[model samples]
Target: MQQIYLDNASTTFPKPQAVADAVYQYITHAGTNISRGTCATTTEDLVFATREQLCRFFGGEDSKNVVFTKNITESLNIIIKGLLHSGDHVLVTAMEHNAVMRPLQQIGTELTTDNAPTDAITFSRIPCDADGALRLDALPQLVRPNTKAIIMTHASNVCGTLQPLAAIGSFCQKHNLKFIVDSAQSAGVVPINMQEMHIDALAFTGHKGLLAPQGIGGFVLLESMIDEITPLIVGGTGSLSHTEHPPRFMPDKFEAGTLNLPGIAGLHASLSWLQQQGIDKIRTHELTLTQQFLDGLQQSEAQNLLRIVGKRNCRERIGVVSISTDITDIAELAFILADRYAIATRVGLHCAPNAHKTLETYPTGTLRFSFGWHNTAEEVNIALQALKEVLAHGL
Candidate 1:
């Protein structure tokens, strides 16, 4: 059986050939650490080149401002833990993942068991509509004088609803608050411009929409934020091994220890591929597939067997679709699809229980089927047919 993978939102599958080749080339031939003037291969040059590539891909003004980390979760931790102080407050949406929430909980006024946080960071949650759109009207009311930043996800990992970044940026500007974005779900799948969007910092992952290998992601921040954020991890940066103190420079201030050269190589190649393909073309293809799936689900909604969990239409949404059904347990359905139909999907809260609550699918979450640049219309049709068959058998 040909297994159909529909979990791009978790981590993209079937990465482009160039990405894999780049990783292989780095591991096989240039299997050395990156330090300037250290290796004849100029491995540092390749690393810096990838930094520049990522800077350009994400609309960062300078390559030096790009800092690498293990993944978006770590990037977010660096931002949340390094920047916000004892009196600082932040605003986040209801759809944020554990990457953001877990850190915020540990830092803020919330009570936690393991860690005692010195930073008394407080946060407010901006509610979302039934369709998973942020309630921007309620945004103004939630702002406190202590609100230092707004950390928002560009796209919901669960429902794929695209947040209003520009409008939110405008709001942040008016409120004199920093706009920090988590672009894990949107980095390569959608266009993001830091300057145009007035973003102070943006975190991204390579394994998802960027179509690169896992274990490498980073954040780009404006030069002004350099002084505001403290480095989470402090160690050997190669540039400043002389003194025990971490480097005060842009990326060195945030990045410590050895970098993931293999993942960087893969990301570098993926960025080039995305540039050549153009995100507009890629986004259109994914949207076309999403629209196809939504149309089929909508036509069958009258049966009361399954219902979409987020925006009914295709507008302002990614290719991630969450569907909840009364026919059978979503877990069982997912297993049947995988075992019998050879269709793989993600089922559960998707690490965003609040998002499920907003979509009215909490406690019992939805079965999510996400599409990628490689997925075809045929795959969408197959998924729809498989869903019908599974639900029919349950009935």
Candidate 2:
């Protein structure tokens, strides 16, 4: 059976040929550890070139401000752990993944803005509408005297609802609060400009929308935030070998130890591919596929059996569509789709239990079918037919 993979939100598959070729070329021909070897020209040049590519891709003003890590989780850790002090207050949406919530829980007292929080280190969860759109009007009331930053995901990984970043950035500007975005779901599919969005920092993964391999992700920070954020990981940066302490430079301050050259090479190539295709084109393709799937669900008889988790309109979301059903075990349904129908999907909280709770699907997760740039309308139709069959089977 021909398999249909629809889990792009987790990680994009069938990466561009150039991306795989770049990774293979690095691993086979130029496998030197950057900043450590005596002959580091090739490795250093490739790494820096990848950095430049990412800088332009994210609309970062300075190339040196791009700091790479293992993934978006690590990037968020670096930002949250490095920037938040003992008494700093934070604002986050109800749709945050564990990447943002776990770190904040570790260092700050997280609370919901609907209720009053104590004067100690505090963080508030902003509410979202039934359609998963954030209640931006509540932001002004949510702000406290000690609120230091607003950390939010650009789009919900569970339901794919696109947040109003520009308006939130304006709110942050007015409140004199830092705007830190987690772009794991929107980096490549959505256009993000740091300067235009007034973003202080952005954390992103290369594996998902960027269409690169895993094990490589990074953050973009403005020049002003360089001094404010402390280094989470401190070690040799190849620049200050003589010094015992970690370097205080832009990228070096956050990036420590050996870099993921192979993964970076893949990302470099993927950036080139994205540049050639243009982000708008890729976004339109994905959105069109999403609309096709949504329309199919609405028209199909299985529509009564499945309830879409977020906004019905495709324009309000990315390519992620999560559906919850009256069936008790959605995981079993997912297994039947995979084992019998050869249709792959993600079924669970999607690492965002908070989002599921906000959507009122807690304790039971949705069957998420996320699309990609390469996914076709025909695949969506096949999945829809498969879903109808599953429902006919009394599931």
Candidate 3:
């Protein structure tokens, strides 16, 4: 039986040929640690060049502002921990993944000079509508005099609901609050202009939309915010050789230890491919597939039994669709779809319990089918047919 993989939101599979070739080529020929050598024409230069490529890909104001991390989770942690102090207030949406929630939970109320809690670090969550789109009108009321930042995800991984980022960014700029975007789901799939969007920082993963291998993700900070935040890790930045103190600048200030050269090389190639193909074209193709999936789901006999999550309109979303059945176990249904129909999907809370709770799909969760550039209309039809069969057989 032919197999179909629809889990791009979790991590894209069958990465682009350029991504594989670049990783293999780097490992075979230029396998060397970066920033430890003084030679002008060394592996370090190649690695740094890859970083430059990433910086350019994201429309970064300065290439030095790009700091490589293990993944978006690590990058989010770096920014959340480095920027938030004891009394600073943070505003986040109800749809954030644990990557943002867990860190904020650990920091508690305040930053203090004596390492004692001074004031509680207050946080308010902007609620989302039933369709999973953030209620931006409520945001202004949530902003306090002490509001330091507003952090939110660009799109919901579970439901593919795109947020109104430009409007929110404008609000942040008008309020003088930092706007940090978690672009794990949108970085490579959507077009982002940091300057025009008024984004202070952006966290992104490489494996998903960038078509790179796993283990390489990063964050881009605005040049103006570099001095305001400190490095989360303090050791071996290679810039401060004389002292144990971390460098007080971009990239080196945040990036410590050896970088992920292999992953970066792959990402560099993936980015090159995206630049060549044009992100607008890729987005249009993915949206077309999404529309096909949505239309199929709507017209199917299983529509009455299945509840689609998030907004029904494709224009306000990306290439993901999540559905929950009224009377069937989502996990069991997913397993059957995989075992019998050769259709792979993710069935769970998708690491955002709060989001599921907001959507009222918690505990039972939902079966998520995320699309990619390579998925075909026939595969989407197959998926819908399989779902109808599963509901008929199981429910």
Candidate 4:
């Protein structure tokens, strides 16, 4: 059986040839560090060019404001731990991943003198409708004087519902609240202009939509937020060895330790490819596959074979779709899809219990199918047929 991969939300598979080549090229030849006064193959100029590429792609004001981390989770941590404090309150969407929720939970418990925030952080979950769309109008009731920032995901990894960043950014602007976005689910596929979105900070992972390998991701923040967010990791930045403290400046301020040169190199290539392909072009192709699957699932739903958990349509959403059925256990269904049909999928709470709760899929989770750039419409049809077969005939 031909293997069908439908878990791009976890990590995009069959990455662009350029991505792998870039990583291999770096590992094979250009083994060098960024701040330790770079070597030939990997220069400070080359890495800075990657940052510049990201800045241009994301519409960040200054390339220096961009900071690299191991992944988006770390980027969110640096922002959450750096910006929020004991008495500070934040607003987050109900569909946020543990990357955002867990850090907020872990904060305020530890009292730090100068490194990180010690005060316990409080937050209210902005409710999402049963379809996983954000109820942005409820923002007024959730904001407080202590509400320092609004941190949220750009797209739902579980259901693919997109929250309105422009509207949320407007709300933040009107209230003077900082806007921070987790773009792990929507980075390369979605067009994000920080200045236009009024986003103070945006975190992104390169492995997912950006088509880069794992262990490489970061964020870009406005210069104004520099003073507000403290550096989470402070050590050798290779820039300022004179003092024990971290370099108090952009990039180095938030970026400590040796940078992921290989990941950065891969990201550099991926960014170039993405722009060459055009963001709108990628979204159009992925959403086309999404619609094909959604339409097939809708037909299956009409026959009572399965139920789509989120919006049946692909508007204002990415390529992720979740389905539920009373026919068999969802996890078991996923296993059967894998074992019998070679269809890969993810099934469970998906690391966002609150999102499950919001979508009324808590306790029992849905089997998730996510489309990607490499997925063909024929593959979507095959997966749909496989779902129908499993639902109709047990084992």
Query: Which is the leading candidate under lDDT?
Result: 2
lDDT of each: 0.88, 0.89, 0.85, 0.89
Pairs of residues at least 3 apart in sequence or in different chains that clash in candidate 2: none
TM-score for predicted model 2 compared with the true structure:
0.97
Clashes of 1: 0
TM-score of each: 0.96, 0.97, 0.95, 0.95
lDDT of 4 by residue, 1-395 (tens): 88999999999998899989988988887777766753644557678999999898888999999988999999999999888877788888889999999998887432233544324577778888999899977889888777888999999988999999999999899999999999999999989999999999999998999999899999998889889999988888887688887788888898778888889989999998898899899999999999888988888899887889999887899999999888789999999999998999999999998899998889898899998889998899889898989898876
Error of 2 at 80 (Å): 0.5
TM-score order of candidates, best first? 2, 1, 4, 3
Once fitted onto the true fold, the runs of candidate 2 whose alpha carbons sit more than 4 angstroms away are: 112-119, 300-303
Q: Candidate 2 at 356: error in angstroms?
A: 1.0
Index of the highest-TM-score prediction: 2
Candidate 2, 5-115: lDDT as tens digits: 999999998899999999999999988888888888898898888889888887888999999999999999989998988668899999999999998888777665464
Which tens-of-lDDT digit does each residue in 56-112 have in candidate 1? Answer: 887888999999999999999999999989878789998889899988988886423
RMSD of 1: 2.9
lDDT of 1: 0.88
* Worst ten in a row by lDDT for model 2: 111-120
Candidate 1: deviation at residue 66, Å?
0.3
